[model samples]
Target: MGNSLSDGLTDAVRRFQWFYTCHVRVPHELVEHSALSLTEMRVLFAVMHGGACTAADISRTLGLDTGYLSRMLTQFERSGLIERRPCSGDARSTQVSLTAAGETGLSAASAHVRDDVSTTLDAMTPGERAQLIASMGYVQRLLSPPADAPQVRLRGPRPGDFGWIVEREAQLAPGGTHTQRERETRTAMVVADYLTAPDPLRNGCWIAEQDGVSVGASLLVDGSAGSARLAALFVEPGVRRSSIARRLIKACVAFATESGYGRVVCATDLNPVSVAPFLRPFGFEELSNQGEWEKHLKEPRAF
Candidate 1:
């Protein structure tokens, strides 16, 4: 079963790559109409966007050999498509910029490519287009290296976010004694309680986002004796090591401290070896019970 599943996945990836290379990247009409090869068009795009950049800069951005890039620049210069000038700061380096003619050529080529892409997308229904865009984004995230991961932004929960939080928490629940339905039910209850909190100032929730997609979440709610309980802490598996969980926890702790909570406590069934490192940095000490952790907060100043 495992071998069959692996083979099927490999075949699917190969098929997608073939389709993308043939149809999605630079349509044949673009090459024929613009008379610019793919590499040339990419170099021109870099130059146009880079704005008075050095040859070294373009070479780094495009990952082209310096010698090959120099040859291309020389050809462009001869054709009056680009201008090169000695760098004011560094005599050894040259600054490159597109000429007016270069911009015009790039714009025409880009329009042709845009029209071709639009023609393909126009055939899909709105729902289909949205699904395609979301699937492509998922593929990009799955394939991109860790260094290329999108920036995570922490924000207060918005309409529809609570539902997302519950759904994701249930989906990513750590395996143990609990069943999936039980986890989902518990998450729904927690979200309901947060939404119905009596004092909004005493309770808080943060949603961690990457490129506007929710990737993690946490809640700081009133606990016994002026304390806050951190609950529903979860980060998507793909984005786990990127500090999304840390950011969510930090936000919760900060909010708890600012809201004048005496301390914050968290209960979890997560492995202590894994959970301790993250919690310890925030001054969270393990309680006598194995699955409990707490961090004492300094009292906020009175007005």
Candidate 2:
């Protein structure tokens, strides 16, 4: 069966793009004097977002082709919007920053965009605005960096993060043989259990947010006795294999240790799911079953 969710998400994105373009027309108006395109506006935003960036940095950040970025920079220089100076540390590269006129132009563009967004948001009811904001936040989180970055961070889940946790986990992790409906139902039950766990502190829930978006998440639950087990350790597909999972495992282990657990364990029916790849680096010992692993928190493990 076709997944309506994919179709819905695709249509929603198209609608949002149309809405944003229809309403946020003033940025183009502000830059009309320089004959800048929307693509050029994005280049300005890249430089503005990053205080001082080399051409390569801007190219990578904006996903602009080297040839296109070079042409754009040359045009921006002619329009007095930007200037490039030799990099102090790396003599081989040049750093680009906004000129006074460029700053003024950028400020005008930013102001117009802000005003348009604010006006649109203000027109909605409080509940509608909150829902819209939360939905946008969710979308941004799910589509963060293509791969995990070193700056990934772990923190306690906020008010509505459990919802996101469920959504991301269901989408990122394979559902095996369960029907779509059954998979969704089971996923919801698991999340509900996590939310209403008996011991909130002992059963820690953390989210890995990068660039102000949740990219990975993990949970620790009190096991059959005094021990605890790691559950729901997942990182988004785009930001995986970049040591994000390692950081997540460390966070869970730290929480379990602080909660007075003698050991932390993770059991799985699937062979080599997280064993050799993600967890073993943290010194987890395998059990006789070959499908379970445990890490005793005898002392603080240095990262």
Candidate 3:
């Protein structure tokens, strides 16, 4: 029994090592092919990703030592790969953009990196690919710094959840309003209408479950055959800080993408107090206010 236990622990460690190394070996391969120093390649990649970013932003994203990043920036300038200009918003900050030469060189470096990484991944069988994804998800959860619970599953609604959702309308409304109770009633009716619609694609709602309880919810309504709008989103009180709202929005985006909609939109009566921060991270941009917000959803993999 003791030998069996030891073997199991060894297997776990091996799986972890595999998970941590996924897609990470490509960078080292690219450094060799790009004929650029590792630091130079890293800075170039950062500029490529951020699109007119600053040294400080890159430093923060990569967790590089600030002085070292400064040296790298100077070297890149000397190499004519990047240019920095004074930031319009802040005099103390400098904005950086890539030159045409830099973009072409980085594109070549990226192609080499992708080829190397694909070769490594292709060695695995289909079963291995599935297992690797599962194991990586485990590692993500394990290494993620503790926070409010995250939502990872999406499923059909249950029988009693509708009433609980109705109750939520009252709880989510702002304080100090003569019309607070009336607004809650109206909101509940709108939600019920959405839930009872015959077609799931036409009108659907998802509840975000965290730690075995629903913390947030969203409703999606078909604007046309090809487009849908995210109607309502709310997170339970006290759980807002954990990023539950973002997870809920992600679920809606995933659903819309899988359901074959061209795009998804969200409208709120005034900008939703809880959703702006969440939606922004998922590439949802504000198109117009119009006494409500309009945000477009892209594919889930984009997140």
Candidate 4:
């Protein structure tokens, strides 16, 4: 049984490797036409994004041999694609940067690669695209070191995000008190209300993204005359306790304050214990034993 399971796992891994190499990698013909080999393009990308980069920096970032990378840099210089200068502080090292010509070349090459990739992605259904992105993120987290973890960013909702919000909220909803169907229905109502809101500037939704995949979400909409209701706040189980929830809440509250809301209130189905840690630090006071929490913001707290 052990051998059988091991063989199955190995086969799965092999299949994934084949699919990745065949389907995920940029086609060789495209790279050939871009005037930059794949490795050269990667080196250029490293230099483009790595401000004040040295030859050593590119080597370390791309895991290329120092001798090989130096040869590439020399070729790039000959082509007038990059400029290198001795570091002022450390004369032994050289600073590398893309010249205008280099930037133009790299941008053009990048555009071609992006267009090619986009064609493939455009063929996928919305759900398939989301799943593929989420799966890639999961694989990256499993394989990458902690220091290399992708930064979480907060952004306004995009197309198909509202549906995802409802689904995720329902899936992550605290169990035992409400059925999944009940939670889903409630979340759908909240999303619908936000969608039909009259004043777009007065209400907001923030989606927390890590590596371009949504992991958490929060909603702030009109409550009373001068209050905003914070609802549908949830984080993915895999990313909970990592300050994503806090960041989402901060964004919502900041938007609320900017929109001239006097206070922000949250009515959660979660018990107080589950919600307190996320709310109390933000000056939210429990308004009831049930899950009502509010924070009166006379001024925005420095986040």
Best by lDDT: 4
The local distance difference test score of model 4 is: 0.81
> Arrange candidates by TM-score, highest first: which order?
1, 2, 4, 3
Residue 292 error for model 3, in Å?
3.4
lDDT of each: 0.80, 0.74, 0.70, 0.81
lDDT of 4 at 101: 98
TM-score against truth, every candidate:
0.78, 0.71, 0.44, 0.59
Summarize candidate 4's per-residue lDDT along 1-303 as a digit string, tens digits. Answer: 469889998899899888977875654644866867888888888899997799987987778999999999999999999999999989899999999999998777667768878999999998899788888887776555554455788898998899988887777776754677788998899888888888767789998987777878888888776888986788776554448878888898888888777799888664456767988888899876666888897743332
When summed lDDT is taken over every stretch of 10 residues in candidate 3, the lowest stretch is 294-303
lDDT of 3 by residue, 1-303 (tens): 469889998899888678655737666777878788777787788898999998888998788998999988888888888999999979999998898988988888788667766887899998798667645554554555555445445455776666666667666667645556765676676676676666755567787665455666777776654777776667665444346666667777777877766677766642365567777777776666453444454433321
RMSD of each: 4.1, 5.4, 15.9, 6.8
TM-score of 1: 0.78
Model 1 weakest lDDT span, ten residues long: 268-277
lDDT of 2 by residue, 1-303 (tens): 559998898889899888876767755665664467778888898898897899999988878899989988999989899999999978989899999999997786677557767888888998798677656766765565554334567888788777776666566556564544454565566667776877666688888877566777877777765678775677765555447778888888888888788788887722346445777877788787666788887653332
> How many clashes show up per model?
0, 1, 0, 0
* Residue-level lDDT for 101 in candidate 3: 83
TM-score of 2: 0.71
Number of the candidate with higher lDDT, 1 or 3: 1
Error of 4 at 91 (Å): 2.4
Better of 3 and 4 by lDDT: 4
